[model samples]
Target: MKLVVQEFLTLDGVSQGPGAPDEDTSDGFTRGGWFVPFVDEEFMEIVDGWLAQADGLLLGRRTYENFARDWPAMTDHPNGAIMNGLPKYVATQSLTEAHWDPTTILAGNIVAEVDALKRQPGRELQIHGSARLAQSLLAAGLVDQLRLAIAPVVVGRGRRLFPEGSTPAGLRPVSQHTTKAGLSVHVFDTAGLPSYGIYEG
Candidate 1:
């Protein structure tokens, strides 16, 4: 199974709370719902395409809990249906029981567990809105592809996709498209480690 990360980011790389004003207010992040202005057909198409290719879901505890609270009640929505039905693997040490159906707890060596999951027979394990888990995955070199919808907004203070101390890796852009609302959708294949060079005069 390939591991893919799908994210909605602001111009300044903020990834937190793109859905609602109160979605994720951690660290006093006041600028939420920044991506709402850019929601158009193109954005929805990209989101739908990601859902269509998902065989399962990999989530952090916070994201899993948030989904468990909201998605089950949205059975009528196509994306909600897909999210509720897909097998969800959560990486956490604190969660004792998961109320969400078809949830597997990945505790004790998360990287190894995810590595095992990737080796399993499946299409793609899609991850959404799990920033901390994403950092870990990137650090471990476990993420295969990254799909991003960059909105034209700048939230000066918020949790970013590539935070400080993140792994340095090269990314090869595989595809890109721009929406009328100024949202840039980019799909990138993960290249191994980054290379450095000095300019010679």
Candidate 2:
């Protein structure tokens, strides 16, 4: 199984709480549900397709809490229905205390655990809205693809998916499309060694 990490981010790279206002305010983030305005049926259609293609879900502890609390209750929505029924792999040390059902905790070594999952026969293991988990996966070269829904606006400051000193890899674009509402959805296949190019000359 290949691991695909997906994120809905602002042009400035803020990935925290793209759905609800009170979801994550730890960084004094006031713009939580910023991506809702740019979403249309076309955007949703693509998301639905990704959800259907996933063999399992990969999440961080905080994102697990958000989905565990909301997905099961969203039976009326198609995307929610799919999310509620999928098997989930969570990255956390406090596995014994987490309350998410149908989830397996990754405790010993992050790379080894995810590597084991990849060896298993499955469609694709997906990570959604988990910046920290995504970073770990990226650093280990375990992430096979990146699906980014880039919204138009830029929130000056917020928790970013790829923070400074995390990883400075370049993504090779495999597919992309800009929505009618100006949202750019880009699909990138993992490429060469993660490198940083700084101009000093």
Candidate 3:
């Protein structure tokens, strides 16, 4: 199984709070819902395509809690059944019990646990909206592909996916496109450590 990370980001690279104004208020992040405006029919179609390829979901503690609470009740949503029914894995030490059906808590060396999961036979084991977990996996060179929907707005402050002093990575572009609502979607395959080069005058 290839670990794929799908994320929504602001122009300034803020990954926190892309759903609703109160979706993620951690650390006083008020600039929420920055990515909501760019959701057109085309964007949703693209998203649906991605969801169809998901064999399982890997989520962070916060994201897992949110999804576990909301997805079960979204009966009217077209993708609700898919979201609710997929096998879910959460990376956490704090969560002893998960109310969501088919959820497994991964504790003690999360990297190793996730690596073991990647060894299983399947399609894509996707990580959706778990920026922190995605960051850690990317740093460990475990993420095989990344799909980013970059909104055309600049959120002045929020937790970024790649913060200062983060591990450097190299990516080769697999695909890219801009939506009618100004979302620039990009897909990239992870390369190893970024190569450095010097320019001669």
Candidate 4:
């Protein structure tokens, strides 16, 4: 299975809270719901397509708890079934059991566990909104694909996807498109370490 990381980010690369205002206020992050304005049916259709391609979901502790709390109640939505039924792996040491149906808790070494998971036969093992976990995988050179829905707004402060001095990565663009509400969705395949050279003008 190819390890895929899908994220929602602001123009300034903040990935903290794209859903609701109270969704994630950790470290006093008040810039929540910034991505809401750019979401339309077109974007949702694209998201549904993404959810369809996932054979299973890999989530961090926080993200897993958040989804486990809400997805069951969203059973009426078009994407709810996929969200609820897909096999889920939660990377956490604290959680002894996950109430979410079909969830496996990875309390051991996350990288090794995910590495083993990637070797299994499947389409895509998706990491959805698990930014911290995604960062770890990317740093370890384990992420296979990256799909980001970038909103056209700058959140002056929040947890960013790529902070200063982050591990460098190379991404090759596969496809891109715009939504009706001005969101840019870009898909890329990881290209190992980035190529470095001096440009002689």
lDDT of 3 at 5: 99
Which candidate, 2 or 3, would have the higher TM-score against the true structure? 3
Cα lDDT tens digits, model 3, 8-51, are 99989999999999999999998798888889999999999999
Q: Rate the local accuracy (lDDT) of all candidates.
A: 0.91, 0.87, 0.95, 0.94
Off by over 4 Å in 2: 194-201
lDDT of 2 by residue, 1-201 (tens): 989999999999999878878888876888788898999989988888898899899898889988888888888987876687788888888856655567788877888999999999999999998988898889888999999999999988889988888766667989999988888999999995756789999
Q: RMSD to native for every prediction?
A: 1.1, 2.4, 0.8, 0.8
Per-candidate total of colliding backbone pairs: 0, 0, 0, 0
Q: Between the candidate structures 1 and 3, which one is better when assessed by lDDT?
A: 3
Candidate 1 residue pairs that clash: none
Model 1, range 108-136, lDDT digits (tens) per residue? 89999999999999899989989889888
Q: Tell me model 3's lDDT, rounded to 2 decimals.
A: 0.95
Residue-level lDDT of model 4, residues 1-201, one tens digit each, is 999999999989999989999999999988799999888999998998988899999999989999999999997988888889999999998999899989999999899999999999999999999888999999999999999999999989999888887899999999999987999999999998899999999
Highest-scoring model, lDDT? 3
> Quick one: ranking by lDDT, best first?
3, 4, 1, 2
Displacement of residue 70 (Cα, Å) in model 4 is: 0.5
Deviation in angstroms for 163 in model 2?
1.6
TM-score of 3: 0.98
